[model samples]
Target: MTGPRLSTRLRFGAAALLVAVGAAASVAAAPDLPARMVTTWDAAGEPTGTLSKTAGMWLVPGLAAGLLGLFALLPRIDPLRENVAAFRVHYDRFVVVLTAFLVALHLSVLAVNLGYAVDVTTLAVAGGAALFYYLGTLLPHVEPNWFVGIRTPWTLSDDAVWDRTHALGGRLFKLSALIAVVGLFVGEYAVYFLVGPALATAAVTAAYSYVLYARRGDDGSDPDAAGRTAK
Candidate 1:
């Protein structure tokens, strides 16, 4: 409860529980799938290539397991492990939300396939929007780390650069999320709303970091050097 205090054990436990739930859902949905099926839409509600019934049932749960495994391994492998600890709570919550997103996607797919009268496209779009919004919320809190946030050469090379880049990135990501939400009403063009803003943010942040780094020089000068000298 206090600043995302769940231990690794707890996080793994949570992931396992979700895996079980997903497995159960797959079982429940199995009867409905054609012996040989083709997936038309991914969980994000976007059109995709086809897959067999077996692949469809196992997809989300398998992905959930793999992602959880990756999350567990990231901290140990990161160069800035302490920095990750500085915002471990945020990271943990992000993982939880991601896992939930996957679970929700699995359910949505199952419901749609089973003729439950649910809209797969709408569910996918809404889920993606939620993830984008939450990711935006977490961006500013993330410290400089190898496996997360706006990783760039400049941001990784200097703390000052990291801070400024993340500040800009935070705003842009939040704005992107908002655009994605609005995109829902735009019909087929909604993917652009989700993707375009993200591309712009990535490009802008990378360039901004480069510019800031260059201005600071190789030794990392203070941006307020002139003002400090004047005083």
Candidate 2:
């Protein structure tokens, strides 16, 4: 089922909330801290950073919320609204889960940067956990649009393409999640682990679309065909 449409006023309100949160976070804590800080690790599991106490505490979550709010505006935009429902479920769930994860990550950063005696490695583990959870949420939908899911020319052209791409995407994202989770244990290689799966998925999806199109042939069945055949 389609979700309720958000009005312009509501959208503006959401944007305002994000701004307020960010502004509040900027000023919330220690008044004498710097606007930006660096992160450092000492021998005793403490995070030393150039961040001011107030700024460090608010930076991550506030930024995360703001970015998410920006993303939320996409569906309401002109071009995106055209196919908003194509992968609505996946898209919505992804946003929520991802935003929540970002919030957690930011909080972890805050704890460490604020000299709260949190382990840096523990933050890494938390990030990995969130990544895994996000993968689980993304793997089960079938739709094609500019954002979320797999977007290939073929997938955009045909519903069949959309379905097949998402099916493949689901598996790839799951695999990616697995690799990323494993990397948490491996240490340092986690960046490679996190990125490799997605790169592989994009390559596979692109190849799959070419093969599908070649196999399907050039009939009116091609969703890209804009005109109808004459009787």
lDDT of 2 by residue, 70-167 (tens): 67777776375656765555566566555555555554455544456655554655465566556645655544556555677877777766666667
Candidate 1 lDDT score at position 95: 87
Residue-by-residue lDDT tens digits, candidate 1, 1-231: 552455756766776788889889889878877665445665455557657789988988999989988997898899889999887877877888889888887877766666666666666666777887788788888898999988888888888788878888888888888888898887765767877888898999999989888889555775756776799
lDDT of 2: 0.59
Span of ten consecutive residues with least summed lDDT in model 2: 222-231
TM-score against truth, every candidate:
0.86, 0.67
Per-model RMSD to reference: 3.3, 6.8
Q: Return the top candidate by lDDT.
A: 1
* Model 2 regions more than 4 Å off: 1-28, 31-36, 39-62, 78-83, 86-89, 117-129, 132-136, 220-231
Candidate 2 clashes: the total is: 3
Q: What is the number of backbone collisions in each predicted candidate, taken in the order shown?
A: 0, 3
- Model 1: how far residue 85 lies from native, Å: 0.6
- lDDT for model 1: 0.79
